[model samples]
Target: MNDFSMLPPAGQNFWFIPMEEVALFRRFLKGKRVVVTNGCFDLFHVGHLTLLNEAKKLGDFLWVGINGDQSVRELKGDNRPFFPAWERAAIVGSLKGIDAVTIFTEKRATRFLSLVKPAVYVKGADYTSQSLDQEEKEVLNSCQALIKFIPLYPDRSTSSTVERIRKGSLMAEQNK
Candidate 1:
């Protein structure tokens, strides 16, 4: 078993934990309310920050389950996840509200969610309880985890950021 307790403090090496070691890590969070959220978090924008910060407020510790590179590609196509899983995990881990980060290689977070069994599971306002995958719903139900949705930032997103970058590159090329 991995000794996550021997690991560095939350900001140091706490993010980017291996999935197999997560159960061990859970031992340290016994008395704390663990909140979990999952996403690709490709470009890391204000909206993502907002969601994470709000998620933290609902519990004592926040665990972010980031989609692995392959999973992101499967869900968002080959060109998605402009930043790889490790890079994305590092970035999210550096943020203030995040406590730990784990990369999961699945289109849905059912497995990770089951393992973490967080007290609260958060999603973007774009997803309603009814819209969630049946498997995800079942996992949450089985674990008795509360499902919450944080409001999304209206004008900020990785997709929009990518579009802006593309347009800027095109404009620059035109001017040259």
Candidate 2:
């Protein structure tokens, strides 16, 4: 049997592994199919969960790469990522489907994807093969990782959630 003693206890197996330590986790995943997905996951919603579950179905191990706080700010603007990277990572790591979570500092998952070299790379349906980041696309191609797209939950997104919060706040202020 594989040595799972180093891993978190059952039901809390999802670990926030540092990039440098990813290789150690890989060793434990030997003989298992690995699936990787990346996103900001700022507000943790059903859409994100759905995608994650779908990705997990494609492989035995599910590794999620989360955008670090600075990366989120660069890609999503200053007001975005209301939740800090550590909190977001913790929330995602707590989910059932994820086996491991890594917070990456890059705006895209190119380097992370290269390092993990997962058997499959999953993305939301919103992104098409042509729309993928050039660097990410190149890395995935070089690694020969299969690209899979899972359908997103309609009308459920962090952006929409933020907008709702803003509108609610504005209305509350107006009433006061």
Candidate 3:
């Protein structure tokens, strides 16, 4: 396990933990409900924390499936993902309440669902039972996973953060 304290003070809690090592956390989920969620998590923010914490509450273990760096680049484009997958994974893994972290390369976490077989699969409030993409819908419907949608904090997003950075830079240039 990476020593989280070795990271910079600003984001010391975020430490890259390889998903292959998740077996160590298995004891936490033994005979207990497990909840799974996946995302790019390029920018760590309050909304992300809120969602993660909430997911943890629904089950005994919270397993976060983060997109690998290559996967993030493929799904989100090269300009996307301000932070590398390792950094993002580390950050999520370091959270106090999260039980395990893993990397899944697919555009969606269907393979992860098969491996973990979580009792619940969580997404933001934007989706519904019927709104799930065909594969996701099939997975949920076929007893592959249970779907749960948490409320979305509409104003909090990575895109907005990127926009804010751009605006800040532009304003600085104007001031000069």
Candidate 4:
């Protein structure tokens, strides 16, 4: 729908959108059923895939929001966001089910959610409807969006992966 070129195709059908184009994208999606989920997505994994795939099933299109690099560092610490925001968005966008991707600087997805106003909003089962950010909840309520939670995959996480790599390196050094 956009006349200008967006970030190159991350996947067969997905679009890596520039922030300036979010309004245009949202307008383009006006009548369609949209699903949304946001996160760091700093490291890709099956857990992410499952969530995105499941989210897509709930609606006609899936729009993913990735935490900006500074936002991730603030929430996940200074050494966080192993991948830059653009790359993370591109990688997440490249996945099989994601239709669109955007990067937001806020630590919470409230602003992004408000802007997109998806028909369904999905999150990992790790969070409860009660435990969600109060402001975010208010925004969702105001927009009348359905909230769905995908069950968390027990063994899949960026933190766990990082630790595993560190432990493997230590063992290799010991063997040497």
TM-score for all models, in order of appearance:
0.89, 0.89, 0.80, 0.90
- Against the true structure, whose lDDT is highest? 1
Candidate 1 lowest-lDDT run of ten: 1-10
Give each model's clash number: 0, 0, 3, 0
lDDT of 2 by residue, 1-176 (tens): 21234445653657777888887777788888899999999988899989998999999999999998889999999887787777777778888888899988888888788888898999999999999998999989897889999998999888898889899999999999
Q: Any runs in candidate 1 off by more than 4 Å, and if so which?
A: 1-15
Which residue pairs show backbone clashes in model 4?
none
- Give the clashing residue pairs of candidate 3, or none: 14-91, 15-90, 16-90
- Which of the predicted structures, 2 or 3, would earn the higher TM-score when compared with the native? 2
Tens digits of per-residue lDDT for model 4, 35-136: 999999977888888888889899988999988888999988999989888778777877778889888888898888888888899999988999888998
RMSD of 4: 3.4
> What is candidate 2's local distance difference test score?
0.86
lDDT of 1 by residue, 119-148 (tens): 999999989999998998999999789999
TM-score of 3: 0.80
Measured by TM-score, the strongest candidate is 4
Model 4 residue 92 lDDT? Answer: 84
Off by over 4 Å in 4: 1-12
lDDT of each: 0.87, 0.86, 0.75, 0.85
Task: Put the candidates in lDDT order, highest first.
Answer: 1, 2, 4, 3
Runs in model 3 deviating more than 4 A are 1-30
